[model samples]
Target: MNLRLYDTAARSVRDFEPLQPGRASIYLCGATVQAPPHVGHIRSGLAFDILRRWLQASGYDVTFVRNVTDIDDKILQRGTDEGIPFWQVAMRNERAFTWAYDQLGCLPPTYEPRATGHVPEMVELMQRLIDAGHAYPADGDVYFDVRSLPEYGALSGQRLDDMQPAADSDAQIKRDPRDFALWKSAKPGEPQWHTPWGPGRPGWHLECSAMASRYLGPAFDIHGGGMDLLFPHHENEIAQSKAAGDSFAQYWMHNAWVTTSGEKMSKSLGNSLLVSEVVQRVRPVELRYYLGSAHYRSMLEFSDEAMSEAAAGYRRIEGFVRRAEESLGMPESVPVPDAFAAAMNDDLGVPQALAVVHDTVRVGNAALAADELVGAREARDEVVAMLDVLGLNPYAPPWAAQSDDGAARRALGPLVDVVLAQRAAARDRKDFAVADALRDGLAASGIVVEDTPAGPRWSLAEEI
Candidate 1:
């Protein structure tokens, strides 16, 4: 498969060629662990997850590294506010992020190295830049000298002269105002580690550069994060990594933001929809579908109406798979359609790929209506395969029995059986009125009961 991706650094879509013959490496900027992940944050993970799935589907060994910024200014502040240790605050939010990722069916990363856990790697990276004359230690703080690197703004496409001063750290002793902190000086109440320069925590950008190099090697294939990180975060990463004489990421991929009311969804905006909160409104699978329905590069506008529409859309695909499985056998190992593959290869065009899935669902439903079980099974197979690639397969584990709605169905099964048994006794006693009442009650509760040769089977009533 000739995979293509839009490199944020190049500002153009290009064919993706892995550095290794049959292996691909990806470094996704993971959570900072200051708070539970909102949908806006998890969207980046979902986008990269789809990309990883596609690469694996296309027959490449993928090594994915998604790191956690467990030590940050915000994390320290949160701990101070809560009157707890910084690691405790970080660990609490980190578990929340892990839960959200798993709830959305994202495959776990190959290695999820925490920022605090890799202080040595971060120190080594800072030392390399300092030795290369691109960084310096001042007043117990290490800063990356931005002007020392001629290609500082290459990734973000802004010339160094046109850039604003780096506001990430104090500029008092910097050689240039654009210089950013590599390691911050320790504050009284914050976490700290010993380094040659001084005792301090790694800067946000420095952690990613160090962790990515440690796991994906000196050079990797793709580095990804949200569009908001395009500035100082990723820009500084490029400058320090390349200035240290190591080739960093081959391609830079960034996902667009999840917006609300024409504004970026952020905690400060008071419109942050946590994944845990959104999943309460919709099933985790439905939420994932809503999040992944749009193009990764497109801004996903979050609205209840849009989310409901996406949920309804997924139910259509899911309804077809469930119904088709009953008439035929369980869907497994079907050939993915050429159209779906083409769409995915074209920069992970999920919207187009999902269109192919819905079209196939239409075909499958039509075949089932016509009593063409063979054709229905074939269509179901293809649909299931496509959904599996997108990590939205309803029949798959975690989404299968673990879904809350599915669990409810399991819990209510015995009660429904009792009702059916009562109705059977009413029928035996020639009480048609009572029998009809039980049936009506079931129907009113959205349960449809059918007496088969085996026994009474029940299903949820189809929505109009």
Candidate 2:
């Protein structure tokens, strides 16, 4: 099946064809780093991660670039509010976002460029826009001449006359109220960079256009961010990049927001749940499953009930995988089921894909119940392969053997060994009934034993 994705610019699902055959490039707008990210913030990361994995699985050499807006208005404000340097605030929160992404098993990007580090590129882009008569420098500030580009509002489908003022800078300094800033003049106690326009930092939109072009070239396969960015943020990026004579992104993909009470979750709303807080309530893998369980274009309503339910669902899948591994002496790789592949191919329909995973788990459980080890192994391997694509594989690194879980398993292993010795001694003395009872009791307590060529190995019947 073809990978058909919902391109926001096209406003419809279209088959994904890379600009370069066997190669895919993606630029995802990452954190601004004013504060630690909430689950809502990480949802986009997980969604795009699945997309990257799917592309690689389908034989594409993927170049994924996620950028950090380290020096922004919000970060500067945060620093003033906390009596710290803006750079300090940016670093603290950027590390938090990185930890959250890694905890959820999202693959690291090929290049995670910081906006501040690419000022030279931003300066080049601004110069190009100015040279093309699409931008102007005034009073130590540079503004994109929105009126010069007829396609200024094409990305967000808004006409310049009908739109609100750009509000990115002082209206008196701009050629047109709709013209957003390409650079902002430095203020007292704020970071500054020297550019032809004046001594100032790069504008928010200007940073992405420059960074994307620098790393991914003049054009890339996909540009992605949360749906909220579709307005002025992405709109301005398109205007400046296209006006500067770059092909820019071939496809625009936006992930829907995670909302609470039908409102977008935000720090201002006082409804945002931090990633660190939520992970304390559920395992990281389960949190990932919950976040990625919905279609990328669909809103995920935040709630404890919904999150708990998702956790339980993942536990069921994890339980089956653990059991199957004990009986089969470790699962080998298996092809994902056609139904699972089809679901993923259809715009990364993770809900449908998860339904397929659970169904396979049920089949594997039934096979195990009937002592059909071969059938069980087949179902387990397929489920694992599918999970691998979704980044939910319980046995994979990062998610595998977490500190507390590993400690618990390591402590339990010795106790189980003692019980196995008792059972073995009972069988050696020909006390078959006592040995059977001990084995049955252990099984009742969620421990499964398998006699292998090496020895009798044991594992938790239910995943930890």
Candidate 3:
């Protein structure tokens, strides 16, 4: 394969060579599900999902591991706020993240491990680091002695002297202020696991290193996460993992963030638009297109106007696909256009690839207009092939389910009409309470009723 990926570590687009021929291993730092996902949170998943699909299309057997940090300080805090257990908070938010991923049409990872489930692996890893004299325990907490790893900042291109102290735990016990925690000693009312050093919880950086090594082995082909993690999170992972004598990830990839109004879209910023809410305004597939249309490395600025334009673009493609299918039957799977492949090969350049999709759609529409089946079919097949690689194929499983929903909506219309008629009669009889009750019942059932000038109009509520 001639695919080239921009290695964040190397800071260049390099040819992708699997560790073992025909097999690729990836460990992506997944959700730290303390809260429900926003568009910013799922963009990384969508970006990597496209990469995984492309690798499969390129004939590589891929083992993808996306770990969930089910134990975290934020999770515990959220639990405290809600008067629930930390695990409950984690599980609830994790489900929300999963629903968002599925609604956006992301494929499931090969294995989605939780940090809490791999305490044994983390213990073993800590032992390895301790034995290597790269880590030490003090005051019931363990810290990775950053000085021990001479190549500590290679991945993130930072100098050890200029780095800030890792405030993950108490600084007084650490030999160096920069020495980050491998494990934090238990506090009152917080969950704890037994470790050789003491009873405590795994550090954020440590959990990912442990999970990745456990699933993909000590060393793997690629490690990916959002760009914000480059500093302390990813750099610390490199320091401890390599200090323990594992070669660790061969390549690093980081997707840029989604921003709104020149600020990063984050809950702390109070500017995050929830995925569940956004999908109500547009189809889930349209949201996917908007998120996935940009180059993975480029920052995507979020706005309603931009989203509307993206939805229109996706609708054009969908309209062409539906029309082509009606005339030529289902398009046979074929190789994507060379232009599309070349764009994808060059660092997963999706924007250029999407231009190709739009170009093909235009040609297909023209062919359909001229009553040319052969040309239309060729264009249709090429478009399907490209969309399939990008996980935007409309006729595929999850998106195809929308057709069934359309039929259900059609069936629901008459039933809702009958109720509205009864509601109208109640209103005409001067029984305001009965009419109000009927309207409220329909609203509770996700049917919105509007008393328009033409009469009563009903529609189903928007679904995430």
Candidate 4:
């Protein structure tokens, strides 16, 4: 099980040797809880899940910690706007995120600590930062002074002098423009806790630092998140942790963004697609295949053609699964090809890994047709084992509901009725334009609006 991963700190791939003998600790940044997760978020989860599954399979005891950022300015604002407690909005979306994770077949972490639940730890961390002169109190806010930490920009590789100040940051809280907050003073309508400094909440970066250290330890194996957080988010985490005179983690891993139509996929962009919505169309397992078919560090631009290809690819695996089941009566042992292990060991090169899957399926199918059940089962189990690395269990989907698809379609009756009425009005007025537009709108919402003789009938779209 010799494996190596690309380390962001070193800017290169190195052999992954744990500090202790057979133990791996991972601290992956989880959802912010501001909104439901989009396709972009699933990519990071799947990439790390690959690492986690690999380590676990290699006889290593892995402690994975993925935090839920239940407290943030956006959440506070949303709660205020909706007239609900801040926790309400975060909890609602956190559940949605978990569903999305299930839909995408991403394995859940060992410890999912919420940011709000660990305020005491966060305050303790802030106190250490303040005592070490790495951070200071300014007007009720505690800020991490970027100039105070000499190696501040190491993670992002950006120098303090060369960087421009962030426009959205609090100008008064920072001694220098590059400095960021460790503790945010509670404003009216925002959630707060009592602390020695004042009544306030933990800043975004410090929450991860505190939660990660508490769960994974001061020094751990990998700390991963999206590449966009490289600058102030991860850089600030590095500074605060080091200032506390403790190492944060061994390898820094950041997954690249997901793109759609040449733009970064995001809910704010209105072009973002939800993993749950996607699962409604295709088998959630196939969505995992589609996402895992690309390199972790490369930007994957998703489209209908790519999805169709993934569906076709998944059908091949399904055929192998069905064939393996049929040939269980024969006697022979098929071996898993070395190509699969080789590709997977190379920093989870799933594109190549999937190619190995194809080859294994081809070989196993030939053996199965020749009445070799023992080897076919072994080969099928081998493929399933590799699939586990990417969090696709091949048995059950995380996003799959216990109820029938028919029942789920019935649940969408009200929404479907609204869409049909709008579409019917457009058709009765002899305006095919509005009718077509209505149909497209319904399809985008995961509803397939079809025009039948009985009128518009709706079902969940297959490629949602």
Predicted candidate 3 versus true structure: per-residue lDDT over 1-464, tens digit per residue: 38999999999999999899998999999999899999998999999999999999989999999999998889989998999999999999999999999999999999999999999988898899999999999988888998898888888899889877555446777888888888989999889998778899988899889888888988899999999999889999988789877889999999999999988999898899999999889889989999999898999999989998998898889878976887799889899999999999999999999999999999999999888999999999999999999999998868889644687678998898888888999999999999999999999998888785458766665442
Supply candidate 2's per-residue lDDT for 9.
90
Cα-lDDT of candidate 1 = 0.89
lDDT (C-alpha, whole model) for all candidates: 0.89, 0.89, 0.90, 0.81
Each model's TM-score? Answer: 0.92, 0.90, 0.88, 0.83
TM-score of 4: 0.83
Please identify which of the two predictions, 1 or 4, would achieve the higher lDDT against the true structure: 1
Candidate 1's C-alpha runs over 4 A off are: 166-169, 403-440, 443-457, 460-464
lDDT at 368 for candidate 2? Answer: 90
Answer with 1 or 3, whichever has the higher TM-score. 1
* Winner by lDDT: 3
Query: lDDT tens digits, residues 39-128, model 4?
Result: 889888888888788788667899999989998889988998999998999999999999877667667889999999999998899888
Worst 10 residues of 4 by lDDT: 327-336
Candidate 2 residue 268 C-alpha distance from true site, Å: 1.8
Give the range where candidate 3 is weakest over 10 consecutive residues by summed lDDT. 455-464
Which predicted model would earn the best TM-score?
1
| Backbone clashes in model 1, listed as residue pairs | none
